[model samples]
Target: MEFRRPGPTPTPWSYWLIRLLFKFVLKIFYGTIVVENTHLIPEDGFPCIVCANHSNSLTDALLLVTSIPSKKRKMLRLTAKSTQFGKKTFTSWLIENAGTVPIQRKRDFEGQEVDNTEVMHHLMKALEVGDAVCLFPEGFSRYHPTIAPFKTGVARLVSDVLSKNRSHSDFKISILTCSITYMHRQHFRSDVLVTFHEPMVFTPKDNPELLKPVDYNVIRDLTAQMHQQISHGTLDSPSWGLVRTSKLAARIYAPLGTRMSLGDHVRVVRTFLDAFKTVRKKRDQSLVQQEDDQHNIDPSFISELETDLKAYQDQLEKCGIKDDRIRREILPRRTIIYRMILRLTWASFLLIISMPGLLLSLPVYVVTFYAVRNFKKTGPVFDTYDEIAQYKLIYGLISGVAVWVIGVLATLPFVLITSLLIPALMWMTLRWIEDAVSSFRSFTALGRLFLIGKDTLKEMYDQRKELHGRIMDMAIALDLPANPEEYFAQAGGKQKGRVQGLWESKAKYFSIRRRRKRDWNETLRLYDKVDYPDDDSEI
Candidate 1:
C-alpha cells in the first residue's frame, strides 16, 4: 500500500480553501487583523525553514500557512507527528487530504535502530527543489510566556540538507523565527500577535559541526529578540524607547489626568524619562553584584525577568490615563457592570449546554462523581469540575462500548447502530459538559470572567513590584544613590522639590525603596555597550 505524502500539493483549490478557512477562523477567534511580516520571507526561490513558537493548539500551524502570501504559502509543507495518522481513518483522511507530512514520534522502531535517514533524505530533496518546510523547534508546547529550549532535530535537518546540496551554491537555506501570542486560548474574539523575523542566512564555509551548538545559540538569541518584539510590538530603537516611555507615562499619569494636552504630555514624558533613567541605573548596579549572587540565583532568573518585564509593559499600555477625571467618573461603574453582565451570560450558556449531558448520562455521571470524590479524598487527582467530567466521559465510553459489543453478539443487525449511536452520544455529552462547565465558570461572578479583570489589575501590581525590586537591588549593588529620584535629580541637576516629594509618596505607599547606596551609571553604560555582542563572541 502506498502511503500519503506528508506535504502540501500543487493544488490551487486546496491552497485557496485553506487560506479562506484560516482567514475566517482567525477573524472569529482573534477579533483583530492577522498582522504578519510577509516581506521578511524570500520573494525568489530559496530553501527555507520556518520555525514558529507553538502556543495554540493546531491553530499555530494553520495560521502560519494561511497567513503567508499565496505564492509562497502553496509550496509550504508542515511536518506533524506520524501517530496522528495511526488507526484513525477520519483523522488520517484529513491529514492526507490536507497534504501534511507525518513524522514518526519514536526514534527506535520494532526492535530496530530506525535512523530516520530516509526521512532526512526525502526532506532534503524537497528543500533542494526550492520548497519550504515548517517546524516547531520548541518540539512541544509549554503554554508559558517564554519559548522553550529548542530540540536538536531542526539542527540535524539543516546540517544534512546543506551537506547533500553543496554544489547548489545558490541554495539559500535560512531559518525564519515566527512568534505567536494569544490574549486567551479558548475564548472567542480574543487577540493574537504573529510576527516573522528575518531569516538567518548560512554560508558553505560555516562549520557544520558547530551548526548544531551554534544554531541553538542563534535560535535562542533570535527568539529572545522576537519575544521582545512581539511583546512590545516593535524592534526599532526609537520605537522601543517610545513604548517604554509611554508605559511609564501611563502609570504615573493615569490617576492624575483626564485628557492629554501640552502640559500633560510634558509631565508624562518627564516622568517616563525619570523612570527609565532610574531603571537603567539600577540595572547597571545589579550586573556588578550579579557576580557575587551568580551561585545563589537560579538559572531561570533571566527568563523570569523577561516575563515580568513584559507584564509590566502590558499594564502600562492598558493604564494610559486618557482622562483621569473621566476615568474616575465613568470607568469604574461601567467596568463593574459590564463584568457582572458578562459573568451572568457565560453562566447561563454553560448551564444550558451541561444540563442535557448531565441528564442523559445521569448514572455514569453519578458513579464518576462519587468515584472522583473518593479518589480526591485519598489524594486529589481530579481537583477541578472539568477533570471530573472528563473521567465521567471515559468511564461512560468504556461501559457503552461493552454494552454495544454484547448487543452485537446477541443480535448482529443492532450492533452497527448501537456502536455508532453509543459513541456519538457519549462524545457529544462529554463535549457539552465541558463547554457548559467552562461557560458557567467564565460567566458566574465566582468564575474566571469576574476574576480575570481583577487578576489583570493584580498582575500589573506584581509587575511593578518586580520592577521596583530589580531596580533597588541593582542600585544597592552598584553603589548608586539609594533613591531613584535622587539619582535622577543629581544626574539632571534639577531638584524639582514637588516632583521628588510626589515620587517619594508613591514609592512609600507601594513599599518600594526611597533610597539606595549604589551608583549604577557606569554599569548601565557597560550593559548598553555589551547587550548585543558580536556574533562570534561566546554567550
Candidate 2:
C-alpha cells in the first residue's frame, strides 16, 4: 500500500518540525554546505522535479531536500524505494509526513514484478497539486566523482504530468537540475557544495489527448541534457592524491600575498586537471579521446605527476605533516613561529579542559576506533573510507545516549542537571579533539619546516621552491592566474589537503588539514537578485 497523508500536502506543522530537526542533525555531523545560485531554485506552487547526482548515501537525498529555500521545503516530495515505507516507525512516519512517495520500481520478493501504474497514479496526483518532486534518476550512490548512467524515470514523469494537464489552456512543468559534491566525504565536518543549474521547461503539444510523435525523442534528448548539466557540476578527479600534490606545488610557486579560500582550492585543482588535459591532448590525442568518452582524466598524467612530486612528497612525510599546512600558513606568512606558538598553547589548554568529558566518552571512543579500524568490507561495490565515516557517526550517537542514561541513573536526585552535563561534556570533548589535533599536527610540522636542523627537510623546501618557480613560469607562459591572492580576489577555489600522500617511511599518512580562515581578498557573493518571470515570460 502506498503511504499518503489525509490530504494533498503534508501538515505544515509536522513537516517543518522534523525537517528542521533532521537538517540540524546533518549540519552538526556532515559539516559546511555551500549552495550556488539558490535564487535559481523554482518557487512553490509549481510542478517541478529536482534531479541531482547521487554521491553520498542517504545523506545525498537529505542534502538536496533540506538545503533548498525554507519556504519551498514543504512542497518538496522525495521518491523513495517502496520497501522502506512498509515499516511503521519514527523514520517511516517522518518520511511519509515529509511528503515522500514510494515507488515499487522493480521486482520484489518471490520474483513478483512491482505495479508501476499505482506509482504513476500517485505521482500524477502530486503534480496536479503543484508539489515539487525530488528524485535521483540514478538508482544508487556512486562511489566516485563520476556520474553514473542516468535512468529515464525523470523523463517519463515529465511526460505523464504533461498528459494530465492537457485540459489546462496553459501547461507548464519544469525540471530543475541540481549537482552536489563532497570535498572530504569520508571525514566528519567536511564541506559540501550544491549548485542549482537552470531549469528545463516543457509546454503542451498541439493535441491534448494524443501524444506528439517527437515527444519520445524529446524525452530522450532531455535526459541526455540533464546528464551533461549535472556532470559539469561534479568534481572529476583522475587522481585525488595527484591533485593534492599539485596544490602543494602550486603554493610553493604562487606569487606573494597569495592565499586561497576553500572554494579557491577546488577551482585550482580542477583548473590544473583541465590545463593538464588541454596540454596532454597535444602529445597524445587518443588518451584525450578516451577521457572525453567518460574515462577519468588520463591515468598517465597522475603517474607523471606522482613521479615529479616524489621528493617533495617524501619531505612532507618526514615532517609528519601535509603540504596544505605549509601552503595555507607558512607560505603566506612573512612570520610563522608566533602563530604556531599561540595555536599550540590554545590547543593544549583546550585539551586540559576537555578531559572530564573525554574520560566519560572514552568507552564510546574505543568502540568507535575498533569498529572503524577493523572494517574490512572490501568488495567491488565497497567504498571503505566513506563507510568508515558513516560508522563513526552511528556509533557516536548511540553511545552518547547510553552515557546520558548512565548519568541519569547515577544522579537520581540531580538527574536533570547531571544528565545534561554528561552528554554536553562528551560532545565538547570529541569536537575539541578533532579540532586540537589539526592545530597540533601543524605545530609539529612547523618545527620541522623551520626549527629542526634536518638536511632532508631543508633539501625538500629548496626543491619545492625551484619546482614552484617553474610552475609560475609555465602559468605566465600559458597566461593563467599564477597568484592565489589575485585569483582568490576574483572568487575561485577548490578542495586541497592530504590525499593519498607520498609513502611515509617513518609513519602512516598524516591527518588532512585545511585553513579555517580562507585567503580571499574579496567575498565571492553567491547570487544576483532576480525577479520571477511574469505569466507570459515563464518559459
Candidate 3:
C-alpha cells in the first residue's frame, strides 16, 4: 500500500479565527478596506486565477486576504518567495498556514532550476481541485502612477492548465483583475481603493505561444484600465469642499481616526473620480475654445484627448465594464449609494476630529497669528535658512507662552479640570502651523520670499475679484448668461445639437468672456494704476 499526502484541509475554524482577528486588527488600526465587484467571485467550486497589481507595502497581502468574503476565503492561496520561508520560522508558518506555495526565485531546489514549472504545476493542481490562487503578475510592489511589466508566469500557468484538460478545455478558468490602491500606504487611517474587474475567460486561444510576444501589451492595457478605474472611480461626484475636506482628513484626521469602513473607502474613491472627470471636462472645453480661436486645432490637443480616452478605455477593460449590460446595471447603482455613504461618513469623521482640535487650539491660535505676523515681517532681514530658523524660534516662543497660559488657566478651580484640554489644543495648534508652513513653502517659494507683507497681495486679490465682477456684467450686457456656469451649460447643449458645429458655441462663449475681462481691465485702468508705484520709484 502506498501512502500519499492528503490535500490541504479547509481549516474552517482557522479561517474564521483569522477573519475575526482581521476585523479586530482593522478596528484597532482604524483601517478601511473597500472591495469592488464581490459578486464576480464564484460561489460554487471553480478554478480561478486572481491577479492583482502590487503597489502597497508588505501588508498588502493581509489587506487582500482579510477583505475576501468568508465563504470563498479558505479556498485561496498565495505564491511567495521561498527565501522568505527559509529565514524566519514565523514567516514559514504564515506561508504554510495561510496556504502559500513557496517558490525559489534565483536558486535551484533539489536539483531543479528555480523555474516556475513546479510552481505552475502546484497551482494547476490546486486549480484542478477548484482553488482560487492569488498571484502578483508583476512579482513585486512598484510605485504608483505607473505599472511595471508583467512576468510571463501567469500566461504560462494558464496555458498549462488548458493543455492538461483538453476535453474539459471549456473548464472555464476565470481570470480576475484586482487592484489595491492607497492614499498613503504606510499611514494609519488611510483610504484604500480595491477595484475588481469582471472575470475574463482564458480560452485556449489566449495561450502562451500566441500571447507571450504580446503579453506585455495585454497586461499593460489591462493594468492601465485597472489603475484608471480604481483611481477615478474613487473620485467621481465629490463637491469641491468635500474633495478638499477628504484630502485634509487623509493628512491630519486620517492619522487619528479609525480605519474607514469598506463603504466609506468606496465613497472616497468615487468622489475623486467624479472630481477628475469634472476637471478633465473643464480642461477639454477650454482647449477646444483655444483651438477654434487659433483656427487650427493643435496636434497636442488630440494627444491629450487620446491619453484621457485611453485611461477611460483601460479602466473599462479592467472592470470588465466593456460588457454594456454589466456596465448599465452595476455602475449607476454602485455610484449613487457610494456617494451618499461617503459624504455622510466623511462629514461625521471630520466634524468629530476637527471640533476638539478647533476648540483646544483657540488660545494657542492667537499666539500662532502673532508668530505668523512676526515671521512675515522678519523675512526681509534674513535669507531662506535664517528666515526658517527665526520662524522656528518664534514658533517655540509662542508654544511656550501658550503652554504657560494654559497651565495658569487650569489652576483656576473651574479651569483646573479643563487644563487637560490645553495640552491637546497646544499640540494641534503647533501641528497645524507646521503643516501650513510646509505646504505654503512647497506650493510657492515666492509666498515665503514675499512674506515681507501680505497686505499688498490681499489688495491685489480684491482688485482682481472686482475686475472679474465687472467682466461678468459686461458679458450679461452682451446677451450672454450672467453666470459662467449657465453660459457654459447652454453652449455645451447647443454644441451637442449640431454634431459638425460641436465646440463652436463653447469657443464663442469663452471669447466673449475673455474680451469682456480685457475691456473691463482697460476701462478701470487697473494695470496702469498698479504700475504707478514702480514707475514713480524708477523716475
Candidate 4:
C-alpha cells in the first residue's frame, strides 16, 4: 500500500479505500456492534474534533474511523502517539494511509503543551479546513478500567485553533464526545457499544477567553468538561469484579425477554446514569418551587426509588444467575419455543451458504492463532488487554491476504474472467460463516436452558420474583410505575435494550471456554441461604 498523509484538505481516494477496508475488518472482529446517535454528526462544512476516551489502542482509532458513514471518511483524522508511527513498517504505513497525525506524548514539563508545536499545527490545520480531527484527550491509553486524567493538550489545542480561525465569522468547530464500551476488552469478537454524546461548540468569540496572557482558567474549565464527559463513557470501579458485577446487574434490571448482552447492558447504564441525573434535577426544581400540583414529584421520592433499584440489583447479584439464564427462567413457554424454532431455521440456511468459506479460512486461522499464543507469554508491554486480540487480528489478516493471492494465482488464465467474482464470493461466504457459527453457539446455550429441567427453572424464577417484588414495593411507595417497562416509558429519554444481541465468536470463545464454563450450580450454592442468612433470617 502507498503511504499518504491527510493534509489540511481532504485525503485522496486511496486513503478512504483503506478506511473502508478497516470498516469491514473491524465488523468481522466484533460480532455485535451497536453505534448510537451517529446521526448527530453534522457534515455541513463546519470544523469538528471528536474527543473520545483512549483505552483500546489502535482498535479505538479503527472503530472511530469506521463508525460514521462512508461519506464522512474523507473528513476524518485520527491522533496517534509519535512513537507508533516513527518506524516505516507496514503497520506505520497503514496508520499514515488511515489519516493519522501524531502527537508527542512527553513534554519537557508535566501538564503543559508548550512543546510539540508542529503536531499542534497539524491538528489545528485539519480543523481549520472543516475536517474532523479525532483525539484522545487523555494523551495515552491506560490499560486499567478507569479513564485517565486528560492531558492539558486538548484544551490548549482547541484554544489555539479558535484563536487562529478568528477571521472566519461563519466558522464554528464542535467537539463531539464519544464513549466506547467493550464487553470484553482483551477478548476477541466481543460486543461494542459506541455512544456519541452531544457536541460542544466554540466560535471565534471563545478565543479571547483562551488568549488571556496570565491565568489558564479557560483552559482548565474546558479540560474539566472533557474529563467529565469522557468519564461518563468509561465504566470503572475499584476492580474488574465490581465492573463485571455492575454489568450483570444492569442487564438484570433491563426489560424482561430482551436478553441484553454485556455491552448493551453497559449502554443501558450509561443512558440511565444521564436520565437519573435529569430526574433528580427536575425533582430538586419541584422542591424549591413547592409546586401546588398534586402530581408534582418529591425529591425524596426519587431518592428512595434509586435506593430500591440498588437493593434489587444487589439481591440479584446475590442470586448468582447470569442475564441470559434469568431471561430463560422467566420467559413465556410459547416465546421460548418460537425463538428456538426461528434460530434453527436461520442456522440451517447459514450452514448451507457458509460451509465452504469456513472450510477455506479455518486452516490458516488455526496456524496463526497458535503462533500468536506463544507471543502472549511475553505478556502485554502496555497495561492493555487488547494485545492478544490485536496480534490475532494482525496475523489473521496477513494469512487471509496470502491465501487470497494464492487463490488468484491458482485461478490463472481464468483469473481475469473470475477475479472480482471469486474474491467477492469468498468474502461474503466467510463473513456468513462467522455469523452463523456465533448464532449456533447462542442457540445451543438457549437449548441447554430448556434442558435444565422445569424444577430448576421454577426455582430460579421464584427467586427472581421474590427480589423483584421488593423493588415494586419501593416503586409503589415512591408513587411511580412499578413495572420495569412502565418505569422506562416514564423516564422518556432513552429506552435501553433496544437492540437484540448477536452470538459470540467461536475462536475467541474456545480460548477461555473453561472459565466461562464455571459451575453455575456451585456458584448459586455459595450464595445460598445455607452459606449466609438473608435479612429474612432463613437458612
- Regions more than 4 Å wrong, model 2: 1-8, 12-14, 83-97, 104-115, 205-215, 238-261, 277-315, 324-345, 360-395, 401-431, 450-458, 469-483, 490-539
Model 3: lDDT to the true structure: 0.46
Predictions: Cα RMSD each: 17.1, 11.0, 19.7, 9.8
Q: Is candidate 3 or candidate 4 better by lDDT?
A: 4
lDDT per model, in order?
0.47, 0.60, 0.46, 0.59
- What clash count does candidate 3 reach? 21
User: Candidate 4, residues 1-539: lDDT per residue as tens digits?
Assistant: 22122334746676777677767666666645667778788573567888888777787877887787755435578877776786866668777777788776654246865457887787787777677888888877755655777777777877787666566555577888888886565444455778788888877665567643525877888888978876776564333433443433344454532233333456455443433344555566775334324434444544554555455445444544344465553556666677777777776797788667766677567867786677756755344344555565566776777777777788898888566765566666655554465455546555656566567667667756664554345334435444655555344222222232234334344221111211111111112111211222210
TM-score of 1: 0.46
Please give the lDDT score at residue 13 for candidate 2: 74
* Residue-pair clashes, model 2: 12
Model 4 ranges with Cα > 4 A deviation: 1-8, 70-73, 107-114, 165-171, 186-188, 233-236, 255-265, 271-322, 326-355, 380-382, 416-458, 470-482, 485-539
Better of 2 and 3 by TM-score: 2
- Candidate 3, poorest ten consecutive residues by summed lDDT: 512-521
Which ten residues in a row are the worst by lDDT in model 2? Answer: 522-531
TM-score of each: 0.46, 0.72, 0.45, 0.69
Q: Write the per-residue lDDT of candidate 1 for residues 76-156, one digit (tens) a residue.
A: 677766666656543354456556676665532466554557766777776666667888766654333334566667656
